[model samples]
Target: MRDNAILVVVARFLIPLVMLFGLYVQFHGEYSPGGGFQAGVLFASAWILFVFIYGLDTGLRVIPQRVIYALASLGVLLYALVGLLGVALGGRFLDFDPLLDAPKAAQQTGIILVEFGVGVTVAAVVMLIFLLFARRRADTVAAGLDPDAADDVREEQQ
Candidate 1:
């Protein structure tokens, strides 16, 4: 797959479209069937597909693990901060009515922020899970370690 020029060429063109559609879904959920969760999964799938077509190193270069963890924490914090902000504005937790002069505007803004935060968190977690699983499998395969053959391996070493 890595060396397949056709696949690589198609991916280079298609991955961005997938990402754009994911973003569209992220924002369009208010009026449609998609939402942060769906968008996040779409984004994560694109990243994983990119990795599969390219390589782990390339994927890591695009988005390092440290950034992923930071964003994961940041997303939760962002969501929480939005709630706290509402409280500070003399409303209940997550009360968006006080976010702006117009209650409708406030509600929309708050909802957007909430969705963005959720999307970020989901994307980060999914990417981390995929990367970890992919890395572990690669490691086991590379090390010639089979879980079922562990006893045989130890016996041979002995």
Candidate 2:
């Protein structure tokens, strides 16, 4: 993978652009068509592309599995805390009216926070799933198994 100079160069150029787009989508979501989910997927896709080009071990080294797990937990906690804040402010769960002096400003703040939380959670989960599958494939190959051979054998059996 590292031997391909063109791919390496293109990836170096595109990965940052992709992440930048993800940020744009995240911040502009409330005003536009996009939101947390789209942004999160974009972010994950960028990382996945990096892994494909650089190799799984390198990807893991860049963003360890433990950090990904923590991000997932942190995102959820952030989401919950926002909702809880509404309750603490004497409103229903997720109510943004009581969040600030101005109801409109409060609503906007709440939406942004919630959306950010969703984005974080989605990105982490996607990365986690990809990492697990990639690790499994690595292990299969390490064990001297042709990963695709199982599928071919299954097809023959059927």
Candidate 3:
């Protein structure tokens, strides 16, 4: 993580802008090339940038890992429930015709729900993966077992 004031200032300025763009991608996905996956990545990157500027501990304190896990699970449940709703409404699985009065509107609503579910899960999982790797790397560095350290030692010996 950087201790530089300029870096922190820049990150603070850009985080909101990037997150807003991610939201745009999320909502405008149906009519544009961006979608849940892209939006999720974008959102995850915003948090990750914060982690980079600050530290993992700070980031986790801001949004605990338990919450992230819950969000992931909730996303999956949301997707499943939307599909189940169609079935419960006397239609096939994921058949959202019964969700609203207009078929087009119902389908769009279903799609949006599904996309949201995917975005949530994807964002959480990405953050989890990043946290896992960052923790491990931090530990390795702490223990002085990092591969980069080994390479450095070898170079010094040579």
Candidate 4:
């Protein structure tokens, strides 16, 4: 990890704010330029910044790999479950009319729920990607080799 103490402090402060902004974007998407997918990426990027500055092991300690995987799976399940609810109510897949007794409200609520799920899945997957790359880089550096050496090795092999 690059140990610029000032940068670390700044990142620590910025990360939560960015995460909070992501939530705002996720929830206010109906009336905003941002949406669940954008929010998720933003949220994931915050963590990625932390990982890059603090190191992969520290990142993992903050958010366990197993938990991230589980959350990603759960997000998919949640989205599917909402669709199933619509089916059970005699509507087509993801038809939100059955989400509530009031059809209009149901549609709105259903959209929100689906968006939430999407955000969760997107965030988790992005973070997972970062984790994998960061871990590989960390390992390579620890092995007394340049982390970028993998690219050269691959090129040579080819």
Q: Write the per-residue lDDT of candidate 4 for residues 10-50, one digit (tens) a residue.
A: 99899999999999999999887887799999989998988
Q: Give model 2 RMSD, 1 decimal.
A: 5.1
Better of 1 and 3 by lDDT: 3
Relative to the true structure, how large is the alpha-carbon lDDT of every model?
0.90, 0.92, 0.91, 0.88
Q: Clash pairs of candidate 3?
A: none
Q: Order the candidates by TM-score, highest first — what do you get?
A: 2, 3, 1, 4
1-158 per-residue lDDT for model 2 (tens digits):
67899999999999999999999999999999898899999999999999999998898899999999998999899899999999999999999988999999999999999999999999999999999898887677567598586676568579
Displacement of the residue 90 alpha carbon in candidate 2, Å: 0.4
- Order of candidates by lDDT, top first? 2, 3, 1, 4
| Residue 76 in model 3: lDDT | 91
TM-scores for all predictions:
0.89, 0.90, 0.89, 0.85
> After superposing candidate 1, which stretches have Cα over 4 Å from the reference?
147-158
- Model 3 lDDT per residue over 49-75, tens place: 999999998999988999999989998
Q: CA lDDT of 151 in candidate 3?
A: 75
Off by over 4 Å in 4: 141-158
